[model samples]
Each structure stands twice: as structure tokens, then as C-alpha cells.
Target chain A: MDVSEQIHAELKKCGVRLAASLPDDWVAPLIRRLDADNDIRHVPVGRESEAVMVASGAFFGGVRSVAVIGNTGLLTCTGELATLNLRHQIPVFCIVSMRGSIDDHQIYQEVQGRRTIPVLQAYDFPYRVIDRPEEIGCIPDAYQWCRLQKRPFILFLTRALLKGRRWS
Target chain B: MIAKEAIRVLAAHRGDAIAVCALGVAANEWWDATKAEDCFQMHGAMGFAASFALGLALSLPNVNIWIINSDGSLCMNPGCLLTEAAQAPRNLKHFVIDNQVYQTVGAVPMVNAGRTDYAGLARAAGIASTHTIDNVPEMEKQLPRLIAGPGPTFVVLRVEPDPSHINTPPVTYEGPEMKYRFGRALEKRFGISVFNSSGY
Candidate 1:
């Protein structure tokens, strides 16, 4: 399967029935997959932090949820992750669109991109970077690790991985 | 007088009602003795208290949710009133206690000072039944009636800030654990499985 399909399958395997996101070019395919799937409730939020809050609420309501946003979105959600997620022990699966990293074309993306890993570390969040399409399948493992650790986890999706050759 | 009466009223009708309070010493005092479904002690997020309570109310429609918000905090997120009025969840009740100042932050006078009109604001926000009570007896008498009445309701309790109390230690929780516990509770209460197979 392709990265999109792989992500969908991984989320399914992880029991994620609902996913909330704000629009971002890097994760558009994944968002589209979520929208197409009738079984998954895809909620588009106004703010990235709102998406985190929605996912947190969904988790509280017995739904396993994930929030997809870009790097800047991560900045918006630092307070929620720290206050509601880290402080309150609310586990949310975060898929961060990698920007401003190696081979990144966007100039503005470098600011938060370089700070992503450190930010996650400050929150003591365990995360992984997916540079290739094959690594998409490792999502289930990452999610499992988060569940077992009982903390937030991040999956960094590089532009190449998202736009690379289809797996299927 | 106001604190004691409000607590007594809440204690008398403790069902599955969830009470949320904004950040302050008074809220901490109220939370000390009160045991409801969930006592949301909002720390940094000021105006989001009512909005968060609204989300909880929507998630658990069977239970009644109450928000004890301060006037200062309420003013910060006034848009919440419009949203509350628009959504109009009958199970949610918002109580705005107007103390006229940022009592927790050295009792500084807010810009508008003691001039906010909560009842009128509620009316403008489309809340049908709005009530204001100053004394203990009035609060005791009106609280139950308001709780029993169809809502989304707004009750503004006018009072002076208690000078004797100090700010409490901040409460924080592990996000995942709290979510899991609350999720399990919701699953048991609603009899529906929200997760797929992996048990998130």
C-alpha cells in the first residue's frame, strides 16, 4: 500500500475511529483518506489547538483519536499538549508534517521545523521521523509505544515520504 | 455567605452533575468540599472554561454540567456566551460569579471594573431565562429552580471577592491516563466502543 493507505491501515489497526485536523498541504492526502472512509469520523477544526482539544475530548469519550497538523500547528498546540495532554495524562496521536528540515524548499518552515524534536523532548514526548514510504507501516508500532508509555507521541512525515512512489 | 450557600445548594442536589470553575482562590475553595461528576479546575485557560464544559456536556448528554466562571475570566472570552446561546444544550448551566476584580492577581481592578452586566449579556447571547441573585437566601432558592428548569441557562451570582483566601497549588494530570480513564468511564456509561481494535 502507499503511504496514505498505509497510514489508514495503521490507524485502523490502532483502533482510531476518529481523527481531527486543520488543513495543511503536506497531510492533505491523509486527510482525504480520513474523509473518504465512512467508518472514520474526520473533523476539521478551525485552530490546530482546537483539533488537539477535540481529539482529547474524543479520547475522553472512549474514542481513540489522532490530530494531524503541520509544524506551525504543533506550536499552536504546545499549551494544550503541555497543559491538557502532558499535565492531564491525555494521550493523543500527533502526526506532524515535517517542514524546514533537510531538502525542505520552504524558507519559513525552518523556524519550527528545527525546534520540533526539542519541543517534543521538553514535553518528554517520544517520536519518530518517517523519511520513506515503507516507514509508514511503523505507525502502529509508534502508536503502541505511546499507549504503553501513556504519553504523547509524534510522527514526523517528510515531504518526500508523502509525495514519493506509491507502495501498492 | 455566597460561597457557603452555593456549596450547600450543590451538595443537596448532587447527581451526575459536573461542575467546572475558572481559576481563582474562590474556585479552589468551592472545589475542596464539592464532589460532582468532574470538578474541572481551570488553571491558565481563562475564558475556555465554559467552552470546555460545553464540550463535556455535548459528549455526555445524559449528565448535567455546570460552569462556575468568574466575571474577569468571563469577560476575556465573551464570544463563549454567543456560542453557548447558539448551541443551547439543555444539560449545561453557566454560573458567572461577578466579583468585579482580578481577585487572584493582587485584587487589581479590571478595565470595565465592576460594571459588567452578565444577565443582560446572557439575554443578548439568546439565553431565555436569565437570573441574578445577590444574597444567600436568594441563591439557595433560585439555584434549584434554575437547575430544574430547561436550559442552556445562565445564572449570574453577584458577590465580593473573599480577601482572606490565597491561591491554591496548580493541579495537573497525565493527559493519556486521564483520557483513558475518562474513555473507559464513557464506554461503560454509554455502552459503546469508541476505539477500534488496538485499544487506544
Candidate 2:
């Protein structure tokens, strides 16, 4: 199976009954996989913040869920994440595209590549980066850890995990 | 119509529907009316309560979900209308309190306040069930039908603003306390487990 399929399996194992997403290129494939699953209710939001708030609400409704977005979109969601999730102690797991990395030639993602981790650190939001196929198995544990932490946790998918080679 | 009175009417007709309120006047007033622990009143994330309610509705398809939104909050994330329309969760009902001012912030007038037609916006976003009520009597007459109708429905309540309630406190619980109370209330009401066995 491919990376998207593997991650989808892990999410199912994590008891995720819903997913809210605004797609970025790297995470779009996984979002498609999630949408195709009939058991998981898919919410396609207009802004990244909506995904966070939606997933937070699902938690209160006894449904496990995830938010999928891009790096810049993740930055756009920090305020809502801090206020809603941090304040209420709701946990939302997010799958993000690891943009602006060495293999990512997109100049627009440069700022996010340099600053995203620090920004997450500033807020004490935990994160994990998966660069290889084998590491995808850890998602279920990370999802459980997110629930225990009572806050937003991110799993970033690197270019190597998807494309297997650098873009020219 | 006024916010408090309108909210009181809404609460009287709440039935078994669970509420998720936006922060500020809408939430404060709903707390005043219902004193419901099951209602999740947002302390922050001002505008996205609609999205929250939508999510909850989708997750709990058997339950009715109501969102008490405000005009200012509606403007902050109008895109939620599109998303709500797209999902079309029939169990969800959305109400926008059109008070023409930011009531909590000392009566500051909202931008294009009286002119912005929120019901129209929702209709444009593809919500076929939309209504605007400008008086308490009209709300009393139309509200029950609207609530019982197939959703996602959008109702715009035109009410007069009162800055005096600016100092009115939010609901008794907040932060994580509000979270636990609201979640526990749901677990009790629906017999669903919102928290893990460890009481997280």
C-alpha cells in the first residue's frame, strides 16, 4: 500500500469517525482517501480554522476526528487553536504537509519551513514528522498521546514520504 | 425584539436540541435564559460556533444542534455558510442575532450593520431554509416551525442592542470546566462517552 493508504489505515485504527480538511497539495491525496471512506464523516471547510473548530466539536459529540491542512494554513489556525482547544482543553489531531523542507522547491513555503516548528514550540503544541513509510505505524500512538495531552498535535508528512524524489 | 427576549423565546422552544453558542452577547444571554450545562458556550473562537455546531450535528446525527451566532461573528467567517450549505446536515439550525452593534463592547456599531442581510447570505450559500424575524411576536410564531423543519436552516433575529448588558458575566463555567461540564452533560443526555475511561 502507498503512504496515503497506510495513514488512512492508522487513522481508522485510532477510532477517527470524522475528518475536517482544507487541502494543501501534499495532504490532498490523504484527504481524498479519507473522503472515500464511508465510515468517516468528511467535512471540507473553507478555512483551516473551521477544520480545527469542527474537529473540536466532534470531540464533544463523542466522535474522534482529524484536521488536514497545509503549512501556511496551519499558521492561520494558531489563534483559534490556542483560544478554543487550549482554553477548553480539547484535543485535535492534524495531518499537515511538510512544506519548505530541503526537497520542497516551492519558494512560498520557505517561511513556513523555517518558522512552523518554532511557532508550534512557542505555543507548546507537540508535533511529529514522518519522513519514511515505516514511521506511519506510529500515528495511532501519536493520536492517543494527543488525546492525553488535551491539545492540538500535528503529524507532518514530508515530501520524501510521498514523492520519493526531489522536484526539479 | 431584544436579544434577551429573543434568546428566552429560543430557549423556551429548545426541546431536546443541544446548543452551541458563540461568545459574547449570544452566549451570555443564552446562559441567562437556559442555565443549561449541556450547552457548549464558546469562550473564544468567536465566529466558528456555526462550524462547531455543524460538526456536532454531523457527528451526532440523531440529535438536533442549534448555533446562536451573532452578526459580527457571522462576518468574521462567512465562508462557514458555504461549508454548512455543502454539508447540509438536516439536524442543524443556525440563528444569527442581528443586533446592529457589538453589544458587549459598549454598544459599538457594527460595520454595515443594518444593511447586511445575513439571511440572504445564507440563502446565497445554498441553504434553502432561511428566515428573518424582526419582532418577538414573529419569532414566537415562526420559530417553532423553523426549528422543527428539516435543516440546515438559517434564522436571522433582528433585535435591538443594549450596551447595559455589557458587564453581564458569561456562563458560570469556563475553560476546561466548561468543557467537562458540557461533555459530561452530553454523555448523560445521550448516553455517549465523550471522555475516555480515565476521565480525560
Candidate 3:
């Protein structure tokens, strides 16, 4: 299965009934796939923070949710993630495209690649980078650990895993 | 109308709606008016209360979700209107307490004060049912229609800022306690487990 398909399968296993997203090219395929699924309610938000807030609210409704966005989008929503999810101890599962990696080669994304992990570390938000399709299976475990942690946890999808020919 | 009085009217007519309140004045007023645990009083994420409420509404399809937003908070993320319009959740109602000032921060005047057309903005964003209530009587008159109407409906409640508002503070509990209280309240109300067996 493709990386998107593999991730989708794991999300289903995690019982993610709702997904809120602001798409970046790297994660767009996965967003589109989830958007087409009937079981997962896809909310296409205007801003990245809206995706974070929506997923936080879904937790209150007793629904498992995930926020899908690109790395820059993830950077933009740190305030909301900290103040809303962190302050309230509300666990929000976020799947972010790992932008600005060596192969990503985008000048606009360079700052994010260097700063994202440090910022997340400053906030004490746990995250993991999935560099291969085989690592996609850990998503369900990550989701469960996020719930147990009771705070925002990010699962980063590298361009390598997403665009890797092995998946095709 | 005073913001508190307008909130009282809304609280009275809230029915079975689960309310999501933005931080600051709107949240304080709702807390004072309703003192209800079913409401999720946001401590931060100034503008996304509307989005949060939309998610809750979508998840709890049978429940009514109300977002008590503020002008300051709304302007912080007006794009929320576009998202809300796109979702068009019939069970979600958005109320913006437009006092034209950030009352929490010593009544700082809002940017473009008294000029922004929030109702028109919501309409332009594709929410067909929208209204602005400038007084208590007007709000009372429109409450039934607004309450019974299918959403996403946008209502802007124009009210006077309380110069004496320093006396009114937010709900006392802070941080994680608020989460547990609100989550446990929902769990009891809907018979759903908002927490795990370990009580996260």
C-alpha cells in the first residue's frame, strides 16, 4: 500500500472519526484521501490553527480526531496548540508534512526544518518523524500515546516516506 | 443592552445547546450568565472557538452547539466564518458579543472599531441566516427565530461594555481542572467516555 493508504489504515485503527486539515502539497494526497472517506468527517479549515482547535473540540465530543497540515502550517499554530491543547491537557493528534528536509529543497521551508523541532521541544510537545512506509504502522501507537499524554502530539511524515517509490 | 444582560437572554434560551466560549469578556459573561458546566470556556486560542464549536457540533450530530465569540476574537480569525460556512452544520449557532473593545485588557478599542460588518461578513462567507441585535428587546424578539433556525447562523449582539466590568472575572478553575470538569460534565450528560479508564 501507498504511504497515504497505510497512514489512512492506521488512522482508522485509531478510531479517528474526524479530521480537520489545511493542506500542504506533501500532505495533500492524504487529506484528499481522508476527504473522500465517509467514515471520517473531513473538515477543511481556512487556517492551520482552526484545524488544531477543531480537533481539540472533537476530543470533548468523545471523538478521536487528527489535524493534518504542512510543516509551516504546524509552525503557525503553535500558540493555539499550546494555549488550547496544552493548557487544557486536551490531546490533539496532528499529522504534519515534514518540510524543508534536504530533499524538500524549498527555501521557504528551510526555517521550519531547523526551528520546528526546537520549538516543539520548548513546548514539550512530543513528536516522531516517520521516514519510511514501515514506520507508518507506528501511527496507531502514537495516537494512543497522545491520548495517554493528554497534550498535543505530532506525527511527522517525511517526503522520503510519502514519495518513496517502494510504496508505488 | 449590556453584554451581561444579552448573555443572560442567551443563557435563558440556550436549551440543550453545548456552548463553546471564547476567552475574555464573552467567556466571563457566559460564565456569569449560565454557570453551566456543559460550556467549554476557552482559556486561550482567542479566535478558534467557532471552529472548535463546529467540530463539536459535527461530532455530536444530535446536540446543539453554540459559540459565544467576541469582536476581538472574531477579528483575530475571521477566516473561521469561511470554515463555518463551508461546514454549514445545522446544529451550530455563532454569537459574537460585539462591544467593539477588548474589555479584558482594560477596554482597549477594537481595530476598525464600530465599522466592521460582521453579519455581512458572515453572509458573504455563505451563511444565509444572519442578524445583528442591538438591544435587549430586539434580541428577545429574535431569540426564538435564531434558536429554532437551522445553522450555521451568525448573530452579532451589540451591547455596551461594562466600565465596571473589572468586578466580573472568568470562571475560577484554571487549566486542566477546567478540562476535566467540562469533559466529565459532557460524559455524564451524553453517556460517552471523554476520559480513558485511567481518567486522562
True contacts kept of 1: 0.26
Model 3: per-residue Cα lDDT over B1-200, one tens digit each? 88888989999999999999999877887888888988899999988888889889988988999999999999999999999898889999999999999887889899999999999999999999999999988888999988998988899999887876667788988889899998999999999988889998
Against the reference, the lDDT scores of all candidates come to 0.71, 0.92, 0.91
lDDT of 2 by residue, B1-200 (tens): 78888899999999999999999888888998888988999988878999888889998999999999999899899999999999999999999998999887778899997888889989999999989998988988998789888999999999998765666678988699999999999999899999999998
lDDT of 3 by residue, A94-167 (tens): 99999988788789999999999999999999999999887888998999999999999999999888875333
lDDT of 1 by residue, A1-168 (tens): 778888889899988877777767889989999989988766665567656655655555556778888888888668767766666555678898887776676788888777878888888988899988777788888887876665668888987788653333
Clash number for each model: 13, 0, 0
CAPRI verdict on model 1?
Answer: incorrect
DockQ of each: 0.21, 0.89, 0.86
B118-185 per-residue lDDT for model 1 (tens digits): 88988997888888888787876777788998779898877776665454433343334434454555
Candidate 3 stretches with Cα past 4 Å from truth are A165-168
**What's candidate 3's DockQ score?**
0.86
TM-score of chain B of 3: 0.97
Candidate 3: pairs in clash: none
Please give, as one word, the docking class of candidate 3: high
